[model samples]
Structures are given as structure tokens and as C-alpha cells.
Target chain A: MAGVAEFTKFPSESLKVGKGFKLAEVDPDTTPGYPGNKADGEALLEELDDKLAELQEKLFAESKFGGTKRVLLILQGMDTAGKGGIVKHVLGAMDPQGVQFKSFKAPTPEERAYDFLWRIEREVPGAGMLGVFDRSHYEDVLIHRVHRWADPKEIERRYKAINEFEARQVAVGTKVIKVMLHISNDEQKERLLARLDNPAKHWKYNTEDLKQRAFWDDYMAAYQAAFDATNTDHAPWYVVPASKKWYARIAVQQLLLEGLGEFDLEWPKAEFDVEAERRLVERS
Target chain B: MAGVAEFTKFPSESLKVGKGFKLAEVDPDTTPGYPGNKADGEALLEELDDKLAELQEKLFAESKFGGTKRVLLILQGMDTAGKGGIVKHVLGAMDPQGVQFKSFKAPTPEERAYDFLWRIEREVPGAGMLGVFDRSHYEDVLIHRVHRWADPKEIERRYKAINEFEARQVAVGTKVIKVMLHISNDEQKERLLARLDNPAKHWKYNTEDLKQRAFWDDYMAAYQAAFDATNTDHAPWYVVPASKKWYARIAVQQLLLEGLGEFDLEWPKAEFDVEAERRLVERS
Candidate 1:
């Protein structure tokens, strides 16, 4: 593992994934808040709400026409990484009916029998649905590789399969957005302590999680490799600096708005037979 | 059609299906909320948020163990009955990753060929997932019956199937919550006018929707029947007065907290290789 100072200084910008997928850093510095900094992000949140509502109306209007565009959002991170919090705060303003969220757990006996992506494929968003995956297929690489559940060769093959899978979704008009919530180890400790200190929040803390935390370096290495192989123009990873919850959430919403903005979602127009409907009302 | 005065005296709580199913009406005045009231409800919202977050932590703790528990919440209503607003503000406090939402639409060619529940069953929450259905299986009884899309006998059969299906879910330990967003026609007109008058909201209005509005009486009858036949101890429907969005949202959060509170979730004892974790951290 790198020194604390060295790790903190790690260039968050210009993440070089692989040969074909060099995602330009969406600078968190440009965002309203940063770690060691505080602002009343709630004011900006209201503005975001207004914009989101407008966008949502457009999306719903498109749905009235049976529009088929779908968006898949994947959030992956370490323990106490704030993936759940980010999702809640970011989508705080949108209508929930338009969105579908899936949180992957350890594979069940049924899931294990099938291929790795089988369960995940089942959860993928249909046309016109917004699917948010909390700790997605990447788990096959993260936990499986770390625990030796799969051999290195198999893990490598799975990584390629993921890239191809995402590319296929994009080709079929599914916009995919992957976000990695990046936080410092010190900040993670603070959050874990916070969870433990509050009785109501105590349920969120698990000492068993520290075992996985011990493999921080290995997980980081695994993340780098997976990002290298899977990040592509079709589905890119937005490494979000998540020390500040508000800023991290807004960053995700911005990415989603940009992705969905590419679609021309117009409401379908049809004439209404008011008299017929009224007669039907009388008969019923 | 009933006159305005007739509507004023209508017993909104009564739900009777076909011939036999008759769900006793609880007093509508004491149900959730009513028209022109929200000042006190705002404070209740903050308290609701605290309560819901606590329940969410417990739900998360349960997920840490091997098996997953999925909760499906269904919200059905007339247009402008506050379905969108209820979903937006109630789930506004819960963790998004733990919840997946799906709003049903008019069946497409692909969907019409199969049984009505096919697409919906596909959207069912996986283990550890919470799913919210906005206008769900009830549509077969409500819209289909009201519009004469199916015979009354078929609709009655569907009600039986729905009852058995929900009972099966309870047998398997799935907690199902169904809420009917109830609003008066007067309130609906005010909301619709508000949308039409606001430029930003004009996009939400569809001329064709007004034709459906003409059949408000028929839809209400359909809804009453649907609720009566489907409401059971395993999956009861809460009739929520949604003239006030704040009151409605808070009510939903409270109901959800109560539902999940039935499960006294505790964290599995912390079992971590403490020495191994410390050694790994020290080595790093």
C-alpha cells in the first residue's frame, strides 16, 4: 500500500483505465463543495430539484409515447464508502417510479449455478426504466478475486465479458453510467465510528466488515484492473470524491442528467373522445 | 353520474367488489389526512425521516446475514391523486439502493400476449431488495373492468388470483404494502389547473388525459371494487387522502417504518480476523 500522503496525492484526475478507454476526469474541484470545505449545498439542491422535475416531466411524456430509452447506473465502492447514501441524496428529487434500484448480495445457490452475470442480467432495466445497481457485477472481480473464489484466468475472462455486456446494452439504446465513490481511509474510519456511536445507526456497523477492509490494497489493485479492462465509451466509470455527501450526490445527478439529455423524449399526441368516455362513465 | 353535492356526501372509505367481497370502511376522517391542511405535517416529516432511517439501518443489518428479505409497496390512485408526489417525498428519506420502483404502463404487443402479471413478476424485488409498484396488478381489475376490456367474471377471477398470489408472498415471508391515494374530484381539478397555469408544468398536461378525467366516476367505482377484493390481512390497502402532499408523504414513511419494524433485525455478531486485519494494516 502507498503512504498516506502518497495515496492522498494520487492523481484523481485523468484516470488512465486502458488503451481504448481514457475517461476524462469530471473535476470534483469544479463542484460546489470538497472535503475540509462546507457550503449550504441545500440551496443548490433546490435548484437541482427544479431541474430534475423538469427533466422528469419530459421523461414521463416520452413514456406516454412508449419510448424505449433506458439508463443503467452502477455504483461500486468499499465498505463505509457511502454508496447507499449517494444514491438516496442524488435521486432525492426524481419520481421513484421511473427508477429501479438493485443491490447485489452474495450469490444464492440458484445464482451460483448459473453464469456470474445471470442474476445481474435478470435485474437489468427494461426499456424506459432507470436501473441503479449498488455493488454490481464488479463483485465477481472484487470479492471473488480477493477471496480466490475464482482463478485469475477466470476473473480476467469475466472482466472482458463485462465490457462486452455493457457495450451491447449501449448498442441497444441503454445508456450506462458507472460511479466509484472514492473516500479516504481516515474519512471511512470517521463514518464507521459515527455508525457505531449512534444507537439507531449501530445496525449499520459490522465488525466482520473490517476483514474485507484489511484487503484495501488488494481491492484498490483489483479496482484499477477492472476499470482498465471494462471502462469504455459505452459505459464509463466516474470516480467521485465522496468525502462530502452533498457534493458527491450532485455530481452523480449531473452525470445522469447529461446522459438522459441525449434522448428526444416528446409526448405522444392523440385526440380524445370526450363524449364516448362520458357515456362509458354513465354505463359503468 | 352523481351531482357535486352527492360527491360531497359520498362515503369514500367504502370498498365493495362484485357481489361478496365487502371491506369494512375505517373512518376516512381519521385515516391519514384531508384537504387544506399541511402546516403541522411539515414537522411530522422530519420526525418521520428519523424513524424511517432507523428502520432502514435495521433492514440493512438483516441483509448482512445470508438470506435477503424483499418488501414490495404498491401505490394506486386516480390521476392527480398524488402518486408521483407520494413516491417522491415518502421514499425521499430511505436508501435508494434498498428500494426499486416500477410504474406500469398500457400493455404493449409483447405484454398483451402474456398474462397481465408477467411483466410485473419480472420487476419483483430480489432478496434484500425493496420494490415500489406505482399502478400494478390492480390495473387488471380497475382499468380493465371499468373500460369493459374484460368480462366481470374474468375480473372476479383475477381478484381471486390476486388474493392467492399475495397470500403466497406472505407465506414466503415477503411483506406487501398496498396504499390507495385518495383525492376528491375538486382537488384533482385544482391540481390539474395548477399544472396548466404554470409554464414549467405545462409539459405535464395532456389533452387526452382530460377525456379520461370525464370517466372519473367509473374509475372510482372500479378502484373501490379492486381495493375491496384485494385487501387482505397479508396485504391491506391504506386509503391515504392526498389533498396535502406533505401529510401523505409522512403517512407513507410512518406506515413503512411500522411494516419493517415487525422484523427485529440485529447485526450478526461481529466475527473478524482482528489480528490478521491489524497485521495487514501494519504491513501496509
Candidate 2:
């Protein structure tokens, strides 16, 4: 992914968690790409919400005008990584119909028996719709590697598989935006404890978060390896800080908006005679 | 079919095209139910557009809060009857993801071997969606009856089948809104000629529309008969005047708005800690 040209619309230096990336050196609390404070971010998001919504509609309406384009946004992070918050806040700004969201959980016996990518292939959005994966096959490399569920050799093979899979999707007109929400262990500990303190949040509290915290170093190493192996020019991975919740939310939304901004979609021309239809209306 | 109580929100006498109705006696240019002029009707529609859109979001979001609901909008009309116009102007105002539209054409050879209702059963929208049928199986009773493609005995049987089919849909939580756009013969001529004159509209000016125009009287008789036989309490029909283009467009929007208005939908409750999450944001 080195020697890549800069994106026409993605000019922000703060959010470019891309190639030559190393996980340990990056600060979890730094808003590297954001220019505004939380209040300014909130105001920016308020304006973006409508722009993103209208862009989605334009993307959808384009297919009727003989344009075939699709988008797949892959979101990967650890427990309480603000993945759900991104969906509820950043991606939720549009008509729910325009986007399809899936949170991939542990594989069933049937799923595991097949290739790991087999379960994900069919779920990609069809042309003209946006598909969001809250947790993706990156889990296979991240969790699977950290827990030693797969040997290093096998984990490396899956990384290559993911790279090839996304390249093929790009070849078929699907734009892939992969994001990893980076948060410090300290922030995660507070989030986990908050879930335990509140009865209403009991449903979100998973004891596995505590167990996984013990292997934090191994998980970080796994994420670094996965990023090096799979981050490609075709579908690059972006890491955004999650400690500042509102900043992370708006940054991710900006990433998606800038990505779609390159497409140059426009209002589809009416297929009928405008003057004639107007005359008909006027006569009536 | 006859004993059901009146619709709670459907109190307009102008929009009713029900059983025991005769086509010739009804004025094609009158707006009996509307309490406004053309400009006022246009303003009302502008208001209803946003109301209908929000209602659709509530309907789609309801199942997350433990409610299951679906809507099927069935539109039947003659050539240049403004069926497509209503879909483009009215249904187009909302998020397209929540609405599914199908313009049913002639049945394929594969579809012809099965019963008429078989093709339709599979197309009904699932829970939490709005399905719009630009043309529905009511064609079986209308054109099929008018052209004598089916014997009167079979036609009679199909009517009974339609009632059972719609009742099943209603029983399973799909609200069916049936509308017939009624336009005068003079208006039809003007529309057909307008299509002929405009090169841009040539694609829409079907030669079949000319063939069907010869059988206009028979088609009217077919429509009258179809209304009497199949206008059930579960899925009644509305005949909105289409001579005035804006009037018909707004009227159909009102009908669908009123149909979904009765649904008791609310914002789906968050399964997580609303209070704690708010606190977490505030702290951040």
C-alpha cells in the first residue's frame, strides 16, 4: 500500500490510519485528524447528517439512470469499541432502507465447516445499496490469532484471503471502506465497568470482555500483523481513536462522506417530456 | 366482506370506490372528500409527504420494539390512468428502502401454469416494509374478464380467491391499500395524443394502449364487475379522480397516509443503558 497517491476528497491528516501503520505507537486519545472540539464536531455532524442522507438517496437513484455502484463499509473493533454507537450515530443519519447492517457473531457449526469467507460472500450488499459489517472476518485474524485458535501460518493465509476477496469486490464496482476503532485499555476498563454498574446495560455486559483484557498485548500484536498483511490500495484500513466518543463518530462519518464524494453522482434526467407533462398539469 | 366497520382514518366519502358502486354515475371531476381547492390540496399534500415519511420510519422501526407490521399498496388503472405518476410523485417522497415497488406485466409462461394468486402470494412485502404493486393480480379479473380469456365461471372463482388471499394477508399483519385512478375518456384521449406528439414520450405510448382504447366501454364494465365481486372489508378499493393530475396524485398519497396512520408505532426502545450511555458521553 506504500507509494499510494492521496485521495481526492480524503484530505484530512488526522484520520489517515493507513499503510506503514503500527498499533502500539498510536495514541488512543489523540484526535489526529479532527480540527474541532466536541461541540464543533457536533455542529459539523448536524450538517453532515443531512448531506449524507441526500447522498445516499442520490446513490440509490443513480441506478435507475443506468449507474451501477455499491458500497461495503467494514467496521472492526474490540468489545465496547463504539461500533454500535457509530451505527446509531454516524451511519444512522439516512433512511434505514438505504443501508444494510450486520454484526457478525461467532460462526455456527455450519459456518465454521465452510471456508470463513463463505458466510460473508452472500451478505455483501447488492448494487446501489450500502452494506455495513459491524464485526468482520478481521475477527478471524484478531481474536483467532490472539487466542491461538489458529496457528500463525493459518492466520497469515486468512489475511491474504481477505485481501483477495476485497479486491474482487472492488473489481465488481463495490467500494470497500474498512475502519478499526482504536481505544486504550484504560478507556475499555471504564466502559466495561459502566456496563456492570447499570442494570439497563446488563444486556451489553459480556464477561468475555474481562477475559480478553488479560490478552490485550497479544491482541494488539495480532491487529498490527493483520493490518500489515491485508491493508491494500484497493481496500485500505482506517484506524480512528475511540476514547473521544463524539470525535470518533464524526471522523468515521467524514471518511464515508469523502469516499462517496468522489463518485460524482447527479440527479437523473426525467425520461418523459418535461414541457408536455407540465402542460398536462397546467391544463388540469 | 360486507360486515366490517368503517376505517377509523378513512372518513372521506370522495375516495370511496366500494362494493355496490356503479362507474357511470360517479363524476370523474369532482373532489367530494377534499375540503380544499387545488392550491390548498397541493399544500395539504406537501404536509402529508413528510408525515407519511416519518410514519414509514416508525413502521419499519416498530418490530425492534415488539410490533410486526407490513403494508401492500395495490394500484389499478387504465392506460394513461396516472398509475406511474402517482408512484413517482407520491411514493417517491419517502425512503425507497422501506418501499418495494413492482409493475406486474404479462405473466411468463412459467407463471401461467399456476393459479393467479400463486404469483401474487410470493410478492407481498414482509413485516415492517411497504410494498407497492403498480399493477396487481386484479388484472386477472379486469382484463381477463373484459377479453373473455377466462370463462365467467373461472372469473367468479378468481374473485372469491382474491378475497381469501387479501384476508390472509390482513390476518398475517399486512395492510393492503387498493386504489383505482379514475379518469374521464376525454382526458384519456388528450393523454394518448400528448404521448404520440412528444418524441420523448414515445417509449411510454404503447401500441397496446391504442388496442385497449377500442375496448374502453368493456374495460369499464369489467372494472365495475371486479369492484362488486372483490371489494372486501379486508381490502377495499379507492377510486380517485385522475382528470385533474395533481388532485389524483395527492389523493392517493392521502389514502396511503391515512392507511398507515392507524398503525400504533413508536420509536424502538434502546436495549442498552440510555442513562449510562448518556452519562458516558457527558463524561467524555
Task: Give the best candidate by lDDT.
Answer: 2
Instruction: Give one digit per residue, the lDDT tens place, for model 1 in A250-277.
Output: 5676667767776765544433343453
CAPRI-style docking class of model 1 based on DockQ: acceptable
lDDT against the true structure, per candidate, is 0.68, 0.77
lDDT of 2 by residue, B76-141 (tens): 889899887777668766655466666688999999999998888888987888888888999999
Model 2 docking tier (incorrect/acceptable/medium/high)? incorrect
Calculate DockQ per candidate and list them. 0.29, 0.08
Residue A33, candidate 1: alpha-carbon lDDT:
27
Residue-level lDDT tens digits of model 2 in A101-209: 6669899999999999999997897676778888988999999998889998899899989999999999887889888899998888788777666654554555456
Off by over 4 Å in 1: A1-36, A40-49, A66-69, A144-156, A185-208, A243-247, A257-284, B1-36, B63-72, B108-130, B174-176, B189-211, B227-234, B244-247, B250-254, B257-284
Clashing pairs in 2: A14-A32, A14-A33
Share of the reference A-B contacts seen in candidate 2: 0.00
Q: Which ten-residue region of model 1 chain A has the weakest summed lDDT?
A: A1-10
Error of 2 at B74 (Å): 3.4
